[model samples]
Target: MGEEVHGPLAQTPTPSAGMQKIVTKHSFFCLKGKWKRGRHVVVVRIRSDRMCPQKFVFTVGVVAFTIAITLGGQVLADRFELANGETIEGTLLNPNERPRRVWLVRSSDGTSLQFDADAVTHVTRETPVQKEFHKIVSEYPDTIEGQWKLAEWCQEKKLEKERHDILEHMLELDPDHVEARRLLGYSRIDGKWHKREQLMAERGYSRYRGTWKTAQEIELSDRAEQTEVAQKNWIVRLKKLRMLVDKPQSSDSAAKEIREISDRHAVGALMLGISKEPAFRVRSWYLESLSRIATQEAFSAIVQIAIDHPDPETRLSATERLIVLGPHQAASYAVASLASEDSARINRAAEVLGRLGVSSAVDSLVNVLITVHTAVVSDGNSEGSTNATFTPSGGGLSMGGGAKRIKVESKNEAVLAALVKLTSVNFEWNPTAWRSWMATRQSPADCDFRRD
Candidate 1:
């Protein structure tokens, strides 16, 4: 009902004169005389003390009931099982007769079929809903309006799959069926009905992991995943190469392979090797390989090592490589590290920024001149103490109280040094005065013009 349609639901067509006669007869006979008894109907009359006319009326009623049951069986349908595992669903003629030599049935397509009684394995009675659906289908026309009526009945009967099938049939009769196509998840694209999946396929999209993605997006994602896997492999390979290079038998060949490494993916692996390799000579090899690669990633990694690596010699070696690569690029990374929560890292980054001699580092350096850090000093004993009574008191008393936390304000000497070196003017950890001085000293374009 929510689907947009070019027009309202179609009205059922008026029946022709001949069709009306047939419908009238069908309605009168089927509604009045059809007696359902587990796929069979039997007419039985009990004699009673009644008039001759009553007996005559009862005999006529029996014949009419029998005739209606015989005609209804043509559409009601029964499933027959054969000895060779074949199944047939149709109406069986003379189904009540047990010892008949041949079985006569009408198939779904109105074809009369006969099977040997000996070859029939079993007969399964149709369910009530199946029988009713078949009977309605036989009575209805094959038009879209007629099929829609059947679909609505199926919906009311809670036959979801049957309803879908009927809707599909309606589409076959009229492809532009607005309600049916919309109910079946179809949209009109370029004057034609298309399901969501079909439209996406036409636009070069594919279903991936339960979502639709374009071909370019899927290719990029796949390539990124592959690159990640390759980088992890390189990490493993570099570790093996480090080991092999230490051996006298394989040192030359392993060194050659390490030197030939050019893939940017190997940069992560090389950075890891440089930080973790304990031997100074092996670390030098990693650094040499990184310098030769000399990508922005490698430059940033070496800068990280310079600021964060635990070994002072390795840090100095990496810093030398940074100078050779370019110190201007290293300045931005150092400035970013100044915001680290670790006090040591802050100091290290400030130290590196100062050595780079970039005046842009002065703005960030002013902020970290003094930082206050909270430390929790937890004591198992509470933060209260008691002393024992002296002189004649026989009982001794001792008490302690809860833990305490302290805030320590640290003045970063490296940040102050960097700030003083960059500006040649000392604020002595007063950020406000430093800001004011820089504000007045700024160029015309750099001025922070404001009004309170």
Candidate 2:
């Protein structure tokens, strides 16, 4: 078919030995050849059969051509070894000299640099993409549209730096090129295009990590990070201090240091020691230190200790400390604990709330005044039928049956006491009268003295 006519229509300088040429009408052309630096050059030209080539111009269609030079032995980036044990990586410009007395490189900043042969120990010039990039740019057009075409080709090859350079070059040709400006991170704001940094500056934003953030946000984040670092440092210090505090010889000094602690960040580390210390005297010291600090975190840890501590005296001590901080705070926390399924916790929380004397917890205390719990009770009964037998020779046997049991209800006394103490009225165990009194106080704006 048309495959015969797809061969090279014409080529200049006739491809020398070791050169390969392939052409396909409306398809693509692949040409391979070796350069002087032992690098193989591959030029992929996408062509449209309808376009006619004028002179030696290689631009063919919308998707014109691409050049990809590959290393001969799998080498990638350029490496230059200096005599002083330093290495330099860049695009080497003159790699095909006969004597190679001089080496030249185009630096990342687009500056031309030269090096004498004696100063360099060795050179590994591989960077095939950079080589092809320079070659294509040398022959490519200088116009914005022309450079944009090269930019598209670089994007296809994933040559980011080269694509960025071509985009910058497009900006130089025409500053208002919309696509180029957009690709280069420029936005049209208020009729003028501003770069990303400039736009961020105008909006009072700073780059944090990779995202834009306000100054206040950055400050808060910095403060939180510093607090975390301080907390970790306190953790390590407290471990050593805890060991010292256990020893009689250094206990006084360690206790003094912990007592003098003013940093709120140490609250978390102090809570760790307080929760794990078995000695009541040492735990008291930890609690005293937390109370001295009095941060929200410290208060919360104290609240948790008041509810979950195994020692009743210690729990009462924590509850007293919370009361010292503020009665309302302790009352709020204790009221929440009233909902616990454990009867003991309900009593303890009621005790805490009653000691705080906050009327706000009256409703909660009334609710848990008599919590009913389910229990499986067993009866002293036999599994099946009871039997009795009397044998000869004075041998006798008899069986006794057991009784069956059922579930029972219980009451919490502490909750009732808390409600009576809070309201100054003894509803005793009657929750309905307590709730009715509470409702009357809110609606009628007067106390209800009637009791059931």
lDDT by residue (tens digit), candidate 2, 1-452: 11222322343233232333333332111112111111122232223223443212121111222222221212124656666554544457787887878776553433334567776687766556765664465445667677778889889978886687778767777899999999999999888988998879889998999989999999999999999999999999988988898799999999888777878888888888777878888778778888988878888888888888888888888888988898787777788888786778888888887777777777777777776654332343545543322111222222223433233344788888777776778878787988887877773322322243
RMSD to native for every prediction? 18.4, 16.3
Residues 1-452 of candidate 1: C-alpha lDDT, one tens digit per residue: 12221211122132222121111112212222122221222232223224452321111012223322223334536766665544445577767786678776654433344567876688767778967775666465677777788788989988676677777767778888899999888998788778988888998999997889998999999999999999999999998998898799999999888977888889999988876788887787788888888888888888998899999788878888887788778888888998787778888888887777777777788888887765444465644453222211122233234444455577899899887776677879799998898788764422222222
Clashing pairs in 2: 379-403, 380-402, 380-403, 381-402, 381-403, 382-402
lDDT at position 376, candidate 1: 43
| TM-score of each model, paired residue for residue | 0.51, 0.57
Question: Which prediction has the highest TM-score against the true structure?
Answer: 2
lDDT of 1: 0.67
Write down the TM-score for model 1. 0.51
The TM-score, computed over Cα atoms with residue i paired to residue i, of candidate 2 is 0.57
